[model samples]
Target: MSAHFKINKQASMLMWTLFMLMAPLSVYLMLKNKTTLIEWVLFNVSSSPIMMTIILDPAGTLFSSTVLMISANVLQFSTIYMKDDKFIDRFTVLVLMFVLSMNMLIFFPHLMILLLGWDGLGLVSFILVIYYQNPKSLAAGMITALTNRIGDVMLMLSIAWTLNQGQWNILYMWETSAFTWQSVAILLAALTKSAQMPFSSWLPAAMAAPTPVSALVYSSTLVTAGVFLLIRFYPFLSSTTWFNQTLLLIAVSTTTMAGLSAMTECDMKKIIALSTLSQLGMMMASMGLGMVNLAYFHMVTHALFKALLFICAGTLIHNHMHSQDLRWMGNITTQMPTTTSCFMLANMALCGAPFMSGFYSKDMIVESSVFYSNNLIMLTIILFTVSLTSFYTIRFSLATIWGPSNCSPFIKLQEETSLTTPMLALSLMSVISGSTLIWMMPMNQEPMTMSTTMKIMPMIMVMSGLIAAWYMNTRQIKHVPLLMLTPMMHYASCLMWFLVPLSSQFTMKVPMYISHNYLKSLDQSWLEILGGQGVMSSSFMASNSMMKTFNTKPVNYLMMSSILMLLVLATM
Candidate 1:
């Protein structure tokens, strides 16, 4: 290992430590300077305002701080988790690039400069997801990349729309009609980046990446990019009815599907990944409901616990001989109490347990919807989604942590303090970040004070999920309860309501089929025959026939003799 290679524990830890310490300076600068633009003067001429730009805005700073904060911890965690792998240096470089790209995307509020980060995340993610040499990893990388490219296309269209606005800077054009289609374009683009609705399956499949990548990217940085973008562009969105309605529809649908799917899922990482999907949907809906502060609040708190959950799951899988099946994991608390406690705490935070990080954000999101929205359907879905969120989270925690000891006595799991240290750091944050953030936030003028009935609704919903999961799982002996195994519902949940097929079998396949057959019928066949090969072959055949005629010297001689005879007769 090189001194700086991630395989070297001290070197990797040292790097992440320095990076983590530096992240807060950005938050400080944003707070102190308030709205400021840093630009490259060389790139701008007096005639045109077009130039490279970086923004120091509150939203951009919040996003930058959250990404680096979570990533710094993940990077440290990776040093220990990936220590056995020889390519840790290469992997570390990829991870560093991933985090750096996120910071750029957040810093440059201008669409032109921001696309650098947008495109960077997509490109590097393809490389990182396919890091393991296997077909599954390759397929996962393709789905992740191609889905993101759709957003990239939407962004290009957005850039073109911004041309109508006379500048590349999105911040400058707010409160104008120029924001019309540009906002819609940004909304759709953000949808793809966040894996909303039709694109939702990619997030779970992305678990094929190394657990550390999942912890850093899917949970905190990459998937959150879209929500972060929406949070930035939210001011312009309030007047757009269709945009708000569309976002609300997609967010709630994703939330319901993800929560139910997590309940049915057996793979630990997939379960956690699905929970992330559910949380992201909530964040999206929060933005739709005109509570961008609450959305940003949930996003930061979700980052802490979500990373903690994934890392703890990764530890269990690492010890269980890389088996991620919940069937193989049982009574983890009995053997690895430290990891178990961290996992439990993280799970509680995810469930928005009382006074925890998620409680401040998640609870408020549902409750505030009362004052923000009048639509009954939207309100019902949000509350129901919260209940489902609790159900799956509790189910997952119970199954793996205290269900039953399904493993053999022969395998002894190693206890590494380094791995747990990162989990502990995040666990502590999961307990404290929300309390600090709500106070630190530039909040709405006042809390949407609801009746005691409305206020306790979220807690009641949480309790229902807890009781329901306990009653159902307690009765199961060797097999899962048949109620949970309902054929149609289970099928939908497990396969993500046929979204994977819709994306792969149809969305992915139709274009691939057209391209493949087009290559066979056109580019590789008749087009080649007509364009390159056809022209060459036809020229050669015609030239060969002419050459054969020219090679017959008698034909040339006869023509010369006839001319000679005509000239002789004329002379006579």
Candidate 2:
């Protein structure tokens, strides 16, 4: 084995060990109803000691454990997925730093301390997103970096705003008149990080990263950081008058947008990336409905299966000679039973199939929506989004796993032991993690009673979605009526409501135009006339005039000197 592989193996094992320890610790903390805050005085300002605070609560510990678990599996998977890369060591280091940043965010409740992790994630994710070292990856990385930097800036602004309260600790924060602005800042930060509408183009773009990195980024780290931050700030944000309603609108729009985008998407990784965006919207919706704990529950459960899904996708892509196009894949079930089985499990969880990890959390969130008392339109959209989730997920599974093979016949598909190890480990979690967390976490303390129709509404939507997906697959796009499915509509859906252009080109267009005008009016015109060229030309003209005067007569030179001296004396 190569030294890089050895290092990755060791790191994976270390992460697994930490995960094992933290899992039990979180359970113990939750069962005992305990929260331990470890504080060290970093410094004092105006007699207000700024302490480095690490809170070991059920939420923080459990989140940290999940991060460690996913990071460990991802690192192990990378050993196979990235085995041939020359800079595996650097990749390993970046992965470790990403995990460290997430853990830092989880444990630190203080806004000031949390910025360390927040900024670290943005910087590290930019590097990772551009890991492939290509023009497309570079463009993707730029979008990812710039979008995330908006969140980082918002977070920093929130921290600065909170400074007026004499404390940066979220635990100590209470609602005040000035807190509405702080809440807006925090919400914007979360929205950007979570890839909510108007800020969501970056998540799909970030698929330019390696598959292992995508698994980590989409599942547990960079993308989810926004949801996690909001979970921490729920207490303060829930009190804000406009927060929940505005979030609900954005969440609904985002979920619908992602679903439409995923349904039309052909690239396997981008489809999965859109699904992550969809789930993030649901998490935000849960928060909007005042179900913070359930939102966290969904986040945790989503992480388990999402990581599994990406790992399996990576295996498929690797075995297919790095082809991520879904239409080119099919009928690999017989060739790779273990991988297909694991992939189906993750898919089932994603679709909220019966008793799966996603079911426990997603079902509850859907059921809880009945109690939200939001407008009929928003509620209907939420349910529609749920069905859309199943629709696209089933569509992806059908295209990649059961659809006709469109690629060369010679492509051999097999699961390597190195790849299978992490898949199996995460597959087990995908199967049982939801139940395990439900028992351990205090997400729901009482049973929910609802009408029979209300209880089965989500499953009905799931089945309808499944049927719709099957129908859509069976019918060719050309066969569909132009009125129902126009090329423009198709293009719009595939491009995510034209957000791809809006985010990249449109975002830059205004600024570029302003800069262009500035260049014309200032740099090229006014500045040329009034700055360097103007100064040089004016000086030349004055020198020529002086030479002419001097050459004409020494008396002219005396007049010029007397005029200059008189001006100096006037100023004095």
The C-alpha stretches of model 2 lying farther than 4 A from their native spots are 476-484, 517-572
Backbone clashes in candidate 2 total 0
> In candidate 2, what are the lDDT values of residues 1-572, reduced to their tens digit?
58988998998999999998998898899888799999998999996778899999988888888889999999999998898898998999999999999999999988889999999999999999999999999999999999888888888888777777788899889876668878989999999989999998999999999999999988988888999999988887887788888998999899999988888888999999999999999999988888899999999989989999999999999988899999889888788899989999999999999889999999888888875466889889888988888888888888877878788998878788878988998888888988888887865556777789989999999999889888877797765622238788888888889998988898799999999999899899998998889989997899798787566687877887899799889999
Top TM-score: which candidate number?
A: 2
Clashes of 1: 0
Clashes of each: 0, 0
Give the CA lDDT, 0 to 100, for residue 482 in model 1: 46
lDDT of 2: 0.89
Each candidate's TM vs. the true structure?
Answer: 0.88, 0.90
State the lDDT of candidate 1 residue by residue for 1-572, as single tens digits.
44544244544464456556555764565446466788774354345567778777666666666666677677777766787788887887888888889988888878887899999999998898898879999998888888999999999988887775557776666545656777778988999999999889789888889989999998888999999888777766666768877888899899988888888899989998899999999999887777788898899899988989988998988888878898887887778988888898898888889999999999888888876646898898788888888788777877788788787777787668768788888889899989987766667547466788888998988889888888877774556644355687678778888898888767767787889999899899899888979999997897578657776677776875687689889999
lDDT, each prediction: 0.82, 0.89
Give the winner by lDDT: 2
